[model samples]
Target: MLRDRDNVFCFTANNLDNSLSRLTFNSCTASSIPSSTLQTPPPITYTQPGLYNVYFVSDEGLPTMQVDCKQIRVLPQPIIEINNDTLICQRDTILLVANGPNLYSALWSPVHNTIPPFDTTSIRVHPQEDYRYNVHLEFTQGGGCAYDTSVLIRVSKVFADAGPDRFVADGAYTILGGPRMSMGQEYSYVWTPPTYLSSIVKPNPTSRPLDVMAYYVTVTNDSTGCFHSDSVWVRTECTEIHLPNAFNPVSDVAVNRNFGLLNNNVVKLEYFKIFNRWGQVVFETTDTGKKWDGTQNNIELPPDNYVWIIDGYCVNGKRIKKQGTVLLTR
Candidate 1:
């Protein structure tokens, strides 16, 4: 008998006097058996594991009968258990264990370099990419048996890249964006030199730098504890020049009396000129502090529209030119 296995038992009878005889068989621990009383007994099946006994009897033409008995033993089946599936970061190591009774040997398929002792019950794996591992178990003691189980170890890759540089006007904000990754998985973000930035810990932050500067961001994967960094340049644009459309130097003393630069940082004042309606050079000056007071050649000009042009350079070596019309009121 075999434990946890299907066993069949058959019986035969011999008649020495050349006469027809009847045969019968019975078992005390058999799960199933046929129901015939002919010269030969039908097959009997034993499913459970244990000790059993069988009895056989035969009746010939004579008054006497023959009897026989036998005993058998069955063994239990083998069981296998393996660790559950799990995830790991790229280049990360993990231990896998298998349990069973009388485990003779084991085999892991889809061999990898990081996995050692591929034929043992336990193995250490460091996979670079996603993989599915199969474990084959064998039992060679007491009714030998073989069974197989599988486990999956997924490897995630990590990466990070901060996007291109950006330009924004002075005192204006610009959005900073880039790529950030960890172990090809989720990660946290951190931007260095956080001056003029809205937030340093966010992926995309707003920056309004006072001067040109380079920004760096570091990304760390949560799972793998790996880190990567990238940089982006934030350039500052020159300040713009604002010109007055019409300045009344006669009636407006508090404002519009002079037509000149409105802001500072003017490196060089090339020239400032004023023209009348006939395109005549009414007034001109190379001094940045010079202003048009509605007079030319020591005479008060008439109330009319006039054109004014100013050219200069900024501190950043950028050239500037501004032109517009002004009104001289009575």
Candidate 2:
């Protein structure tokens, strides 16, 4: 092999008179020696590299014959494939193992804890970001030549946000789930406790719950087989006073004529008040059955937005206090 090129070069010669017998070893460090009377010269040892020439001359009694230069060429030495390039989720660990024949030493970059005598070496790696691991294997016959291989360990940063806490009226539908970060093809989503939800695999699924519920969502990377999770809550204002957001005092529809709960279930009405934009008290009452008729001091008030407040106890004996705005249309 070119790595350790050592050869013995000798010449065969025929010269009876021994008048002309010679050998010329042509190389980078050119040298020439000759033997007389058809005797072969001592073997020439080649130390360096590249093309070499062996020139020989023979002389007969008739005519002298000389041979041209003969050439020899020499060329540097050039996968202990442990594993192919791989991808994984963050915070996860994987094993990198390699087994090869006649190994003297094996080392991996981005260092890890390893034992000696690395003929067959295996190590565990956990990386946070994308990284490329380079492996160097030195064989016993390498003769100072280095053999190398590499495996790319790509880290996929995964995240899942199940949206902010939600507030929905009882029996009302609301969408769930928020943001997510993932990698690989055919990525999928999963929402836990799929009850009352329209879809479990969708990033944002509709839900209709009768009571408070907590939902969790997981985002999975199909290629890396990695996942991340987060949770959110859906609280229900299920049993309380229901106030109309808009009203028309001059409308023929009786339901749109006044502003108040359609049917009061309040066991104890603490207070009920409505204020204008300037925080002026326009309508105030404590009687649950007596609702506002869009009037103040027996005069019709102008149509505008008004803030309404309620502090009372439901028929189920649950205390409630809340405030909201309502439109007053003539």
Candidate 3:
């Protein structure tokens, strides 16, 4: 009689007499075996772990029969357990663990950015994109058994682009456009240097900066907590030119009554001219520092509205022209 751990078992009988007519066997195990006329019995498999009894009978056709009985025991197979699958952001790491009894060796298939020497029960893995990892376990010393399992990990990529740099007039209010990004409706936007912005939390905000400045926006994934940032330069241009409405030549020695450029951006004055009500030129000058003192050829003009036109160039080499009516008072 013999006991074994494996589920399948084979039995054989030997005798000197070769005239054996028939042979039959019966077992109390969960499965049944086929009858055989030869000396070897067919193999049988047991489903459950337990003790089993077998009875055998042989007939020689001479009114004589031989019978034998035996008892055998079977053991259960080893069990394997592994962790469940998961999802993570790009460039992130995750741990994989496997559990088993009397484990001789373990291996992970489809090699990736894993910690070196992946024979241990636990390992750290870094996958660039989505991947599936397989774990093969073996038990050789005590009981020869092998098992196979796999786990899937999904990697999501987060990216953001804040469009391009923009140019606007100085001290002017304009709408700042937002960036084009992926993973729509799953991200939040925030603008930095919120002092001159109409809204800080919105993707597109209004800005009115007094000088040249740079702005930045950060985009974050709400579910994964992944963030990316980009900047948009708010380049300011010297496009503003202010003109005075009225000036006084008499009793105003301290203040110049000249109708000249009032902005600090003008670098050179191309031409300046004054026109009366009948479209006749009264005063004209090509010098930027020269002023119209409400006089024509050194004569005090009357207190009436007069049209003035000024053409100049800014420090940035941009052409500028301004026309307005100024009131003169004696």
* Candidate 1 lDDT by residue in tens digits, 46-134: 56777766555556445766666656565665677787888776656888888887989898876774466688888888888788788
Once fitted onto the true fold, the runs of candidate 3 whose alpha carbons sit more than 4 angstroms away are 1-81, 113-115, 164-180, 195-199, 204-214, 224-226, 230-330
- Selected candidate, larger TM-score, 1 vs 3: 3
Residue 48: error of model 2 in Å? 16
Off by over 4 Å in 1: 1-81, 99-101, 112-117, 127-130, 154-159, 164-188, 206-330
Report the poorest 10 consecutive residues by lDDT, candidate 2: 1-10
What's the TM for model 1?
Answer: 0.44
User: Could you tell me which 10 consecutive residues in candidate 3 have the lowest summed lDDT?
Assistant: 1-10
Q: Judging by TM-score against the true structure, name the best candidate.
A: 3
Best lDDT goes to which candidate?
A: 3
The Cα error of candidate 2 at residue 23, in Å, is 18
Question: In candidate 3, which residue pairs clash?
Answer: none
Over the stretch 72-101, how does candidate 3's per-residue lDDT look in tens digits?
554455677777878887778899888877
Predicted candidate 2 versus true structure: per-residue lDDT over 1-330, tens digit per residue: 112323435555453555556656543543333322335555554444456666656563446665656665532232364877888788788788765666667777756332333344677777787777677776655354356777778887777778899888643578887644443355688898988898998888898775778999898877667788989999876466668789999899986899875433465678999998899898888887778889888899888999999888766678788899999998
Give lDDT for model 3. 0.72
